[model samples]
Target: MPEFTYDMLVIGSGPAGQRAAIQAAKLGKRVAMAERRGVVGGACINTGTIPSKTLREAVLHLSGYRLRSLYGASYTVKQHITMEDLLFRTDHVVRHEIDVTLHQLMRNDVDLFNAHAQFVDPHTLRLIDLDKRGTRAMRHLSAATIVIAAGTEATRDEHIPFDGQRICSSDDVLQMQRLPHSLAVVGAGVIGLEYASLFAALGVRVTLIDKRQRLLSFIDAEIVDTLAHHLRENRVTLRLGEEVSGMEPFNDVSGDRVRIQLASGKQVVTDAALYSIGRTGATNDRGRISVNERYQTNVPHIYAVGDVIGFPSLASTSMEQGRLAACHAFGVEATSVPALFPYGVYSIPEISMVGRTEEELTAEGVPYEVGKAHYREIARGQIIGDTIGLLKLIFHLQTHALLGVHIIGDGASELIHIGQAVLSLNAPIEYFVNTVFNYPTLAECYKTAAFDGINRLGGVRQDAVATSSRN
Candidate 1:
């Protein structure tokens, strides 16, 4: 037997990496983790998820986007909310999160190396210390089992170079000194739309460009349509089906604007350009894991998970992927996940869904019925000044079982969990219809939608009426 030093070595200190390391350590295995940053918590807690979410919250509050209707457009004294306000909360939250994460790791006895790590072989990793005083300062390490959760990097396309002034990536948004009066966001994916929405809310004239015909093409079309309408209402322009041909930094244009020429023969002059389509596996450097089923690489001892592996690159799913990988690595069979999982887009008016989309159902030839409840019709939505939102429910025609739930509006992400639970349990539409939710709540929409779906199942409608009459 080859002498293995540590029982497990977790690469990356993000949510997935951290969870896997802690889980393995709890199983009485000596574990260690490699973190590129000087601090412990990975990009999720540090830059990407937490920072962006905090920025969105700050933008929502200061811009008075939430209270504009109630206060009659005079709510915001300062139309511009500074980056400091956004970064202040982000810095506080991330520091606390990192401190808590370090405490947890210390309690679990997981060694943390603040250096860049690469594969020496299948089982060995060479960690090079970033601080350079002399030539031979770094060290090498080996482990029995390795988990690759290095996450992903921003996709910097060849056409546009990020100079951090005229052009930048999502990471640069937080560190920006002055806010732009107008911005061009290339790529209408989650990251692109997120920043675009927040900036538009802050009164920056934004032009969003996407190569595809629609934004978030994989989501429920109705939900995407609603979100797009909201974005448009904020004065954000959509330039779909257009690609960037070239970009020139207009150094002569005062106040740092970028002149971009599009493939559609459109010239866009914006205060700055943000390229958000950059996404590639962080494991490209290590080359240890095969991007295969169960997230195992060529070396059986090494594994990969989260955004690095590709589709459904959500922080929520990424954490689960990490846990499942850990379970399989330790030879413990865990509960199998159902086909249905929730989707969340954290825009100003968020979007979330669970189970099959209407298009997917149609393509599969599955007979289904849909029931919709607009947020405007719901009391809670009116109370919160949210008039532009919708809840959609799909059900199997024969079985009256819940096939999917799609939501777009405030608290859509949180509200989708109830639908997720129902789908996971294989509950029928009647389950929600029979269950009475609290009055004047967003959740009541689910009940209303369920009733509508159940009624569409043909016999359920008569049966419900008969039962009601008997009662």
Candidate 2:
């Protein structure tokens, strides 16, 4: 066998790539990571996740949306919030994330290369230098194993005339020179909903359009219905079962206003429109590389993870995928990631869920019972003024084993983990009922829900009744 430059060569420096490189380095293997952007973190830190979430926090703080009920709906945190106000904190957060990522790579002794990388062969890569101006210097390196975590980019269609001023993608939302008086978001997916809710909180009239009749159908139907209700209350118009046929600038308007025509003969004029329909894998030409359960591509010794492989494309899951792939490459035995990890959508009223949905269980003919606790019924919920939040638990009627958990409200993302831990341990519903939680806390909902479910199972089989007591 020919001598290789490094044991592992990782492409892209996103969450997955960084984790893979660091994991291999920790194992005392020579590792190198190549990034085209000349930065340690990929689009996740530069454009997509970090920037968007930071902007969301700014909007919440400056808009005074959270205190509207207590302040009688006539209070504003700032008289006039501008684009600069929203981006001020975002810039700091991005810089901090990049610095931290770079420090991690340096401390682990992973070589960093700033260049565009392309495969010369299965075992070799060609790197085009990105730092030197106008000089086309190229370098080739071979490795024993390769991992691709190139991430994804926002999709754009030629039919849509995107001037970046009137018609923009989600990536351009953060770069706007000023806030729009009104906005139209052209997708009902996670990205679309998050941005729509954010801008709406800033007192912008937002119209969300989608061809699908429902939003986030994969989530719990009851939770989605609640989100839809809150969105409408926030003055966001939902144009479901509709599609944008075309769009053009409104000549009658002096400003940058666009007229969006729909297939349903409806017209909407807004200062700007965000087309967040979908995202494409960043892998050149071949699209997404297919991978097996081990995250290895069709070509042995080469692996792909994260958004490039699709489905549940989240930073948290991507990190785990990278670690698992690295362990497998070095012949280290490790447990696979759990099939039921949490899914979080960071909208105004966040939504999160773990395990199977009620729809899935019903379709599979699994005998299950649902227990629910509304925030309005809890003291902590009233103190925080989150009357709309809810916690729902699903359990097997026969076995009393916890099956699933769903939550929608503030801190939903963080709250879902408690239920996740219980489900992971294969614990029964009695665990919550038998335990005590701190006072004036949202976690007490678990105990409330457990008792609710137990009360519903009044006429269970005698054997099952005895099992509950023993548990």
Candidate 3:
């Protein structure tokens, strides 16, 4: 084996890069991670997941969205909510999370390089020092294995003049001076909808525009509809099937405003706009490289994971990807089950799903039946003042096995794991039906939905169940 500065070199200190470096260190390999940001957690802890989620929580609390059911329709926790109020909680949480990431990496013996890593060659990386305290402006790093988890940057249109305040990208949302009285969010993708919901929750008039006629087409249609309805209830205007022709920013006596011209000749004037069309690779457009089952790129020693790989660009899945890639790089036995992973959208109401959607099963011509439990009927929902929540369980009608589970509402992200377990274990609906969940809890929805499904089956069951019933 050729000598190298480190056995594993991880680019970016996001969830994936952090996990990869830590896993390699645990394997007794010299691991080092290069982070362009002065902080360790990358976008996940700073601009992306942690900040957004904390902002959402702060919005929910200050806006009184969580307890609106118990109180009146016009109820509010605070009469005046400011950007500083929201950022107070968000900044605290983000700083703590960054500390945690930094501490974890330090304890694991992963050397940190606060520098931008440029590919010098297949086995070498040229680091551009970001901090002036560095003795050298640039340095070279060599490693036997490399993992590309630099994550992504928000994509911007050339025409939209972004001043970071009025016209901002998803990456700069946290940097806003103040909350806009109205917001225009272009593109109804996950990031768009998530930000739309957040601002809408804080009493901002949010107009969500997307070229696609439907919102979250990949999600279960019913769940999307429910989310759309909730957004509407929160005064978020849905402008679907609208293509933005252009944006004109003008400064008035009062303040700056932007007029978004649509292809349909309709125009919308807003205080600010968030251009969240999509994201691109942070380091390079290396997605063209082929990655095998082990997450190895065409360059076998190089691996890619997380948002850099696209599709399920989630912090949770990215961590698993990094772990698996590190293990595979070190010749450790590892397995991957991408199908069983859960997709959670951290919007206002929150949405989570595991396994196939009804649309997917229908397109595949698979025989399936759905059973639903509404939060309005659940004791926990009533106690928590959440009435619009719903849990849906899809079962293979003939086999009585769990096919999919989808939930929209409070704790949907946490609740989806129950169904994920059943789907992964190939457990039938009977598992939920027979199992006991705590009273006055959201988990009871599983039992309720499962029984609802079994009842619809109308005594029809798989041969095994029928035979057992007869005996």
Candidate 4:
């Protein structure tokens, strides 16, 4: 019985929780993870990242968003797309993600428990099984170390009435039974913008409302401007620097509609509203726990990671945080997270960046030169009908060392990795200039941008070498 007790226990099966348990099991520790949902992959796989991205892909394909420019503005790949059409792909992807996560845990010999976990003490946890009807089964378990990767929940305010129909949260969007003709997105965060762009691509009139003057202020300003331009071109309305005062349901011939009143004495009526203002840590009543650099809570043996830790709550970063926490718990030395990691926003046309932004470098008084490569200049861009995409590279004016890479357009998320690799190695601009790349590919943009940067610095132009390459 003593041996059966877990050496490490992780609550929540998100990217963070899954990685934490796997890391602990890899260290030959008895590891177990408890998830409230019957599924293993937590919110990321079930509702947040995986499902939303899948839905976006489906919307893009069925709506003929990419082919619109070449085929004409009125052309649509599919005319009568329904909610089921979008959810079919999303459901399939989510199930596959959950299965993959389960397989990973099983192969690593990590025990899985389906229950809501609550701390009875520092080391002991009470697991309540709500799956059983009429009777709630409870089990108590003791672990040498505990990880609270419970993630976060979509915040709900009492002032707003969310019916999961007329007005819904981001999570509720996944469970929507039908698509609305028009939608008013009440937030302009990543999730809000992604959904707004997706729906707009599907021919829905989307109005994005936010109190802030800009969207995703953490991103490079130029990239944000490009995204804003694309959103406007797609016919998505922006209502920035305006606060929503209240909402009321109105009955119309088209069915139920939401009248959103703004603090600036304005009103907008839409078929539905998506309220995606923020999220709160799902750590039950205990809330977010404080952690040290090693991800250890004040109660030494306890740790927290992922969205529960707050800020930059990306699935990729969450996975790393979980692995690092496990390493620290087992006294294993782990490499610190890199100073620069890529951030991929899955909005229509996409946006990705790594390293420091131009704004940050300028504010820090770091001398840098900017190099840009528009997709129109790349052969593959025309082939794929993404001529509006742009890649910007920032490098040290003196050292020619790669400083930042920002991209906004189709496949921007995929293309940013090349820049990330160069940045991680602290490689100089000449690396890209001298390196041979496959012709007629988006990857060639790096070479072009590098040459453009070198030329701006008055270095010898390598344009002849790049131009002479075979496609």
Candidate 5:
């Protein structure tokens, strides 16, 4: 084998890049990590997952959304929560996360290069250093293995220009100078709904517009319906199936706002407009790496993972992808990440699920049965004044095996893990039905759903047996 300078070179410092680098370091490989940001932690910590989730937590706490029913509307001593209050914990959390990443790299002895890495070839990359402390402005490095976990960036179109003052994107939301009294979110996707819900909970008049007939068409219909109801209850005006015609800056007004014209010919004026249409892989248009099934780019030694590869742009999945890419590069055995990964939307009244959607099941003509339980039937939900949440279980009719689980409401993200574990193990609904869950807990809803599924399965079995007997 030809001698290589470094064992691994990881580009991008997001969850994927960080995990890949750390995993390679654990293998005692000499590794180098290149990051564009001055901070080591990528978008997940700085502008993406961590920052948004922290902001959501603050919004939930400040708006009294969690305790509204128990304490009543008057429970809000302060009617409004400032952007500062929401962002107060962000810098600390971001700093701590960055420190942790840096510590891991230090412990693993991975060289850190705060610079932009551009491919000179599959094995060689040119690094442009922006920091003045560095004497050399640019340098070339060679590595035996390369991992591209650059992640994804928000998309913007010329037709829908972003001023950040009026029209903005998800990344701009967290860094806003002031909170808008009223906001309009274009696109009802995960990021859009998340911000719409957050701003609405904080007393902002929010209107969420989506081109789809229903929000989250990718999710189970029941869960999405429930979530849509919650958004409406929170006073978020949803304009589903509406197309955006154009946008104009609102000026000569007491407050800065944007005017949006809908395809339905309705015009809306709002203090701020957010376009969360979608995200695109951060791969530069000039990217030279060829990506394969195992995440190998055209440059055989270079690999791409996470949002940059599209599909599931989840932080959890990206972390694993990073580790696996590193393992593959190191010629180590790596477990295949399951396809039945859970999708969690961190909006208010979170939605989460694992496995196939009902549409997919129906399209494939797979015979299946569904079992559902409302939160009101669960003791913990009643105690928490949550009657709006629900859990749905989907099972294969022939084998009685668990096919999928979907939920919308509190703890949905945490709860989906149970279903994910069962699905991964190919466990049947009986596992949930027979297993005892703690009394009055949200988990009981799953138990209830399991029993419902089992009963349905039994009905199908008995009917089949009768037909066989008749024959």
Candidate 6:
């Protein structure tokens, strides 16, 4: 005789769901979470974030990509790398992350359910237990507050044959056995760009196609241009403004190949295809819920967060959304600052951005001046051999206040935070000019860029510049 009851119940164990459950538990409220995969961390840990990044590192190291500037192009650490070598680190890290997440949930005293959950009523869910014997035992769980964070699955075309081998979806790409000589990445989103960059570093010819004419329209045009140039240099073919009308997977004497037909009467035949067109929600729409300032739905007790709620679906923003939702549901009083949430794309020489973009500032008719730091000019950047790296800082022309931070280089994701902190505090460019940083560090780029900007504004005496640099 078991009664499954709680104050809050989260449907998925992803970043958003995990954070939501922990927040409610800390409030002394009964909390439980259901994960259909029988794993504590959802796609973010098991497949998406951890596996992809780990794979990138493996490719970069084995191929000697980062050190090519110093050691020459043919200086690979390993002569020939196999799928086993790539998966070795990814599998190990994923297992460790799962253990860590499970321990955190247990430490927080949140009940865990390894079952698929569906709402029987507005406030109740029928959790279908995942069983190996094909016999599923069901249970009804009731809660005062409910959160839907089931995440999403890769979208695949029915017309295209996907056996998880020669042709596969983004989710199945990691489970692949053999490495192909060529790859056709049929999307230009963050996932597609990252995967294309990784495989290209491994000497795979990558043809990246998309319906859009430009890459990352949200990113700064200058940064995108640099990335595009670098990608082309790495032997990645950009097929922008192309539409895939049809696809057929076939076998020839040379083995398997997928022939993709474009709308403009062109054909692309590649050894493998990673169909990452988009992601679709795994659960029902929950009555096509409209997400608002608060994470509440039309139904009083139900709430939605994370990728399920749509755009800017980053794990960073999703975690904050989950915490805010839990606080709002309990009337604990909280506020969200969407402007401060940073975006990081995990591509080769990954791009990270915060605050306004140059395009946005120009569109708004805001007066601004651009300050840029090239990695080649910095000591650390030369040591790292990231000559193409660039960091752009946008500041208001008159106020001299920092308006935006955009970086495309090595450790761009980590370095963006320094600019983010300054932007969040509404600090001026002089703060960077006056601040003293450790010598031979990438952080010195901030000081370099600040001086560059102040010089652009004109009227600064050499004495004044020297005095500020000393301080």
How well is each residue in 173-216 modelled by candidate 1, as lDDT tens digits? 67777788889999899889889988888888999998889888
State model 1's lDDT. 0.81
Q: Per-residue alpha-carbon lDDT of model 4 for 176-288, expressed as tens digits?
A: 77899999999999999999999998888999999999999889999999889988988899999999999978998878899999999999999999999988889765666
Better lDDT candidate (4, 5): 4
> What is the C-alpha lDDT profile of model 2 across 1-471, one tens digit per residue?
989999999999999999999999999999999999878788789989999988988987898876776675557799889999999999999999999999999999999999889999999999999555667779998899999999988888778888777788977778888899899999999999999999988888999999999999999999999999999998999999999999876655457798999998999999999999988888875677789999998897999988889887899989999999999999999888679899999999889999989999999999999888887777788777778899999999888899999999878888899999999999887888767789888898887777678778764343333223211
TM, every model: 0.94, 0.95, 0.95, 0.96, 0.92, 0.96
Give the better candidate number (1 or 5) by lDDT.
5
Query: Candidate 6: deviation at residue 45, Å?
Result: 0.9
lDDT of 3 by residue, 1-471 (tens): 888999999999999899999999999999999998878887889899999998989988999998988997678999888899999999999989988998999999999999889999999999888556665579999999999998888898888898889999999988999889999999899989999999998889999999999998878999999999999998999999999999878877768898999999999999999999988888665532346778898899999988888867889988999999999999998888365789889998999998989999999999999988999888899999999999999999778789999999999999999999889899888887667788889998988887677767676344223222201
Pairs of colliding residues, candidate 4: none
lDDT of 6 by residue, 1-471 (tens): 334488999999999999999999989989999999978788899879889999988888888888988888667888778878889999999999999999989999999999999889878989999688888989999999999988877887778888887887888899889888999999999999999998888888999999999999999999999999989998999999999998888888888889999998999999999988988787753322467888888886788988788877788888998999999889899987365768898899789988899899999999999888888989899999888888889999988899999899888899899999999899988888778889888888888888787777774534335433312
Which of the two candidates, 1 or 5, achieves a greater TM-score against the reference? 1
RMSD to the hidden true structure, all candidates: 2.7, 3.0, 3.1, 2.2, 4.3, 2.5
Clashing pairs in 6: none
Q: Candidate 6: TM-score?
A: 0.96
Question: What value does the lDDT take at residue 206 in candidate 2?
Answer: 99
Model 2 segments more than 4 A misplaced: 459-471
Candidate 5 lDDT over 1-471, as tens digits, reads 878789999999898898899999999999998998778878788888889988888877777777776787446535657778889988778888889989988988989998888989778889998866655589888899999887767877678868776788887777787889889999988999889988887888999998888888889887888788878887899998899999878675476779999999999899899989888767776433346767787766788888788777789888888898888888999886667788989988888999877888999999999888888777798788677788999988878788889998889999999999989999777777557778768988877786666666555343122211101
For candidate 6, the 10 contiguous residues with the lowest summed lDDT are 462-471
Candidate 3, superposed: residue stretches over 4 Å from native:
132-136, 285-289, 460-471
Candidate 6 Cα outliers beyond 4 Å, as residue runs: 1-4, 285-289, 461-471
lDDT of each: 0.81, 0.88, 0.89, 0.88, 0.83, 0.87
